[model samples]
Target: MLAALIRQAQQAGLSPEPGFAPKELHWLAQLHSGKFTGVLPLREGKKGRQVARCPELSQPEMMALPRVLGQTQAAHFLADSCGVIALLPERAGQEVDAKTQAKHGAYAALLERAAQDLPQLLPVLEVLRNPAELAELRAELAQRGAKATDRLSFAVDGLDLLESELWYDWWRRFRRQVFGQPTTTGTMLDLSSGEVVTPAKTHPKLNKLGVGAMPTGASLIGYDKEAFSSYGLQAGENGAVSEENAAAYRAALEHLLAQAPVLGQMKVAVWFDHRQAEGQALIDAIENPATLTQASETFSWDDWDDTEAIQIVQTPEQQAAVAHTRAQQLLSALRRGETPPTLTAQYFALAISGASGRAMVRDWHTGSLEQLAEAVATWFEDLAITNLSGKRAKRPRFFSLLMNIQRPKPQSTSMDDYLKPIRNLQLPLWRAALDPNAPIPFSAVAKLMEAHKAQVMTGQFSEALSRDGDGEDKSRIYTRMALLKAYHNRKARRQLARGQGGFLMSSSVDPHHPSPAYHCGRLMYLLANVQDAQGSDVNAGVVQRYYGAASSTPALVLGRLTRLSQHHLAKIAREKPGLALTLERDIAAVWSALGHALPKTLSLEEQSLFALGYYQQLADSVSRRQDLAAQRKAAAAQADPHPATSPLAETTQTEQTAQGE
Candidate 1:
């Protein structure tokens, strides 16, 4: 049956090559001789006999048939066609020859069968099955046979065995063979022209099968072993090499190259463990100097002009021009009584701005002189009432205003105690006016004028009186007035003396007259009456000044009272010689109180002088009183000659004289 099938296939234009051997032929002859049955049927149900077997053979013959065939052919269609007879195992050692013949024979038989069954397969068969008709096919098969000398080669050669519909269609159109011989494919084929050239056919199965035109001695051209290993390909694996793996490797290479530009420029010292050939290939492909040059050309400045220049130098004349322009603008604004935007403008154009430049503005507005004056005047009026009480006045209102005005710069650090309160009030008021809502009291304003008067009295006053000439004049004037008022009021009040007689006698002017300290108290009383009658004139500087002066009178009067106490002690001592002892004790009590007050009252220089005089006078008076007391006691003890002559009476007279002395 196999021989008859071979003959039938050959008759139908299938070519049987001489590669067939004795064993394969014998296998076919046995089938023709009815020595074996075809295949066994497991179940007895369907067609013909109850125990179905080959029609021309017995059960034993059919059983022996499988044993006669080799495992390779037994698994394939060796007995089905004579064209495939050469593919059966004829000799144990000729594996390569047998396998190649088997593949070609199978293709021949398939083509012939296809031609007979489907007329559409005729053209493809004419080109592939008959060596006489398709010389190229015969040559390709021979080339494939020569190449398939090893396992890898055989696997590659097996690619031609793909007998699918698309392969047949490709065969019909191009009449080209790519199985063994190097024929055109992949960009080389002109499929549109129907030319017998290699077509660019990316065969999915061929790629998956890893069947290339030839075994690339070192694996498919750019196959990455490591990548293939990731896909389960190890050192030794069975079956055909997967074309999918090859394609995957190619795709991976393309991806790497696409990312090369960015990676190449990265400052990473990449290292890899690869076979020398692979490493070298990667280095050569990625480290091309030409690529770097091309990349760098993208930013080269070929069209730039180096000779173009710019001038940076500023001339003295130009600078002077700028200064003059600024000066003129500032002067114009100042003349309009407008405050300059900045201190620099104010200072440079002060002369041209007139009084406006020097005018006191609030400290919140940068503390100009005008604002300080206002604050001082306001605080001075507030301080007036306390200073008039004929008691030592507590200048708490002045201290509070000073604290407010000085803010960050303490007044004590910058001004004398006499002038500090007034200056402090003025400075912050100047700052306060910069913001309209900021407080600027009438008392501070009044004190400002008084401070001006105080400045006039002090020799420390500046000659820069005109605000237009110098920016500091108004500040200086305000400072001076505050100092002058503080000093004048302080002196005037000191002239009034409070005593048992309502006021002390002033012996310097009139021995029997009341002291200027007493008069100061009267003046203060009169000023209080005037203030009570007139409502506080918030705008009047004169009212504030007089009020400040009158208020300070009591402090002066208290100081005079202190001095008067010492004076009376001296007068009593001079008037009663016998009472010197009593006088001395009273005087000592007065002196002790004065000693306690003196330190606080006197300036450093005055304190030293006064302490020295007080101690000196105290020592002299003590010594003289002691001597007078001793002399009187001695005389009383000597003899009363008239001795109603009680020793007790004598002693009593002596004691009385001593006590008087």
Candidate 2:
């Protein structure tokens, strides 16, 4: 991994050379002929900042300045604060302590010492030694509203001292004497020249502890405690990796993180071995496969450059189909014995979280891009389930799938607390999406089930089945059913691996399914429908009253509901015999499918099947109702082709004749 990272950084033309790193300097200290002129802000609001190849020393470099509690070593170059430059007391109005005074002297002394070798540093040293000039520096900063803590670097005669090679070499030698020798060793792929090289022997010890652009104290390879030390290794001696390799790896990771997709507190860095892969495209393909399929038909290579032709394709989606279609085409080329641009490249992903101060690597994934695409395609296929319209429902985005498990927020709960479960499930769920054979986490299914049951308890069934303007059935409910189906499909896959057959849930209701719990769920929905058909407003109907009991202890509640359903059926028979008979037949079909006796109590898995069966039955019934209504309308239209001269018009004429008589 470290070798790969070093290669990546070198290939990107980023110099990961030891003893030097990129730092953003906030202010530029203008100087002329050994005299302080003024300070200028490197960046204003919404403006770019100046970056310098500053000298970095130590594992975790000291902030503000390079000084310890009692030690008075000045920051060699690039002090981050006025306090370091002027030796300001720790607090305002406080007297300068002896240690601070020593640091002040050391700051000038280091420059004086460096000036001997690099004559260009002599002017900067002269300004640092003058008290009046230091006071003028403070006054200039105060006028510009610059805080004492802002980072600033010096410039003399249009020459940035930090960017000077002479200063860099001087600082490198000083760092070597203070810190120990560089221990980096081993052959690594030199991405720059595309050859293997020993960077340890060629580069200096210049690695710093941090993840991205910001330098952090937290370490991924720190041995701060005695217990962490072993094999004759002492504390602070990170024997696992040399500083040079670590720096290269850090630079590579930082590059990846700069463009990685983020989920909650985690940032996922995805890349191809040869080139950078569009991570969002992979995520979108998994989240909404149908959209990619639709986009492919209209996506043209020519339209890419025609702004007017592709004007509708803008931010976020931003011609998303291009990536998806191109990826598929590349994969197709490989299968057809043609050389594809991205043929046979491996996909790499690393998910990391730095919320705990220490950097934590949550997951590392690697696979052929072909396998990744197949896995994502398989994920959507397994999750296929019908909507309330009895059509295949849209797959929710990956984030939406996780969000479905979150409990309804209470007024007192913080957003962070409410989203904790979703955050916890991100890594496992992401892994599942990437691995076709991996099962959806059982804990995730359980949480979703709990949420589903809670919605039932609160009489949310009607809302779940409600139609939206886009003709989509209730999205949250559809997501729930899809997740349930996926859970069962994965379980079946594992069971097949074990040489056993298991029930697999389909996209729509299957009346021939053998599970009594499923049929019971179907019966539950049918009974609820019968009660609703009575045309009476009941505060709490069958689903709200009996769902929990029926889903858990089917034997106890289903039989009672079946008996009560007869009364509702009888009322419907008196008013609409055809509808009553249809309901009766539907109930009989569900009972016929239940070949086994109803279990006394359901296991968690069985309960999920029950919910799936219930939702699918409802969706099928809705489709039937829609089809029946459309059929009736068509029949009426056929029966009276000449609607303007029909029975109603004749009846009105007869009534007028009677009035005349």
Candidate 3:
């Protein structure tokens, strides 16, 4: 039986590759089992070679060579090379031609049946018969004839056909296969009443079996040639019945409508139009009456005067009022922790005759109708129920008031206008606290206090107070001066407590005790500080004056002068006072100190500020003395001419004495 099977497979165009012959049916059995593996020689041109040891033979290629050669001498040669025992030709129940014809008839019948209900089934059936799947199908069909007629059986057959390797091979061959060729290895056949008509030899590239061609044996089974030609399918053109398809498609549409409540007490009507026109159908088979009515009406903006065709529900004035009321209500609801509901249209219509015409009812529901009603309700409910007992809401305090005072009003007249009125009034008092004798200029003091207050309020005073001279030397000097002035005020208050009232003494020339060297050093430091503040090189006279003054004065006075000069220089530097007057005063102070012994080790630059200070002091003293002399001369002129020289002088002396006391 196995030998007979092999013979039948051979005659039916089955063969194996070289170096793959059967031994006791091993090669034939292995080939049928799909497990045999070997190389097959392939050569171009006329070079003969062993079929084994070929570089280009894939496993499928090797397996297919024998099948292609069939029971011919080529099959025997290929089988010999592969070392497989060849099956000799033997009658296997029927002649090859007869068997081939029967298979073709079967295929033709399958194609006809596929074309009737589902033309998609033909390609699937072609797959089943290519690789001996017909045998299994035939056996299965024979055992279950009733089951084979069911849709599930067709699905199973389709899946099995797709899974088979023969399916892909047959699909390729079907595209290339020709009719009336005896050697064509496909099952498609023609069954006709007339003699088997031979096809004429035309262009090899022409696809005669394609749709719309004359009905050859292969084409006649699944399609009508006459009808295809009339429809232009055979003319290699598209059919002109697309509108018909659309009409048919539209007739099969289904409409879905939803009616739901949106908000708490309003109804929502939603109409979904899913109807489609199939083929050439102009109208949707399943359209809603309301939508169709609306679509049929023509609208024109210029037809407002046609009152019978255009009725107004709410006039423009009424609409504005309604909109305003709605806005107010929405605001009130938000304030009262309530969710606002949406307002939807009450009616819809075809505006054919007038806007007042009764609308067609498409869908209707009496329920809640707000867009975000649920979301709004949830938000308000969450807010009302949240537990916020221990959470402290921040409130403004005294510090906020202070900050508000310092902040400048936008349209101020000047710096004075910008400063708080009370702060401006306190400037003199602040300066008096620093030094009674060295009362700062009111404007300069106010500016300084404002800056200091800003720095303090910003929490920068402590850090500024702590920093010494690093790279920022000028800032260090300013910080030191501010601290020292603060210290001097404290010391003066302490002195006043002890009844030693010298708080108003001149910082330049006080003579009670030997002044400390640190005082002279501080004065020299201040001169340098001021010069640096002015962005200028040091002048010698300025340094000399301070050094000489420090040498003559008591330590207390020296210390006071040091602190005072530092404060005053910082003030002057920041204020940029009139330099002429300042320079004169400084020069006069240096000149007055010149009456004392000078330091031998003083540098020329160090002597310059002192010289300048002496000149300045002299100029001021002369100016004052000259003014006094002029006043006396004027008084004498105003007196009686050459009269009462002795008695008048005595009366004047008595009055001066009483006034001085």
The candidate scoring highest on lDDT is 2
lDDT score of residue 585 within candidate 2: 87
Best of the candidates, TM-score = 2
Q: All models: lDDT?
A: 0.29, 0.66, 0.28
lDDT-best of 2 and 3:
2
Superior by lDDT: candidate 1 or candidate 2 = 2
Candidate 2: what lDDT? 0.66
Q: Which rank order by TM-score, best down to worst?
A: 2, 1, 3
What 10-residue stretch in candidate 1 is worst by lDDT?
A: 345-354
Per-residue lDDT value at 140 in model 2: 75
**Candidate 3, residue 27: lDDT:** 16
Q: What is the TM-score of each candidate against the true structure?
A: 0.16, 0.74, 0.14
Q: Worst 10-residue stretch by lDDT in candidate 3? A: 274-283
lDDT of 1 at 285: 23
Per-prediction RMSD in angstroms?
45.8, 8.1, 40.7
Tens-place lDDT per residue, model 3, 1-661, is 1122222233323222212211110111111222222212222233322221111121223334433433212111111211111111123232234433333444344344333554444543453334454444333333332121111112222232222233333332422341212233322221111122221111111111221222211110122246656643442122221211211211111001011211111112222111011100111101111111112123222422211212223785554333333323332344455544333311110101001111122222221222222322221221121001111111112112122323334574554345445333232322222222333233433343444434433534333323433223223223322322323333444567778752422212222212222223324433433443331223333433444444334243344544455565556544555432344354344324433333434332222222222222222332433344455545664685565568667455433332222
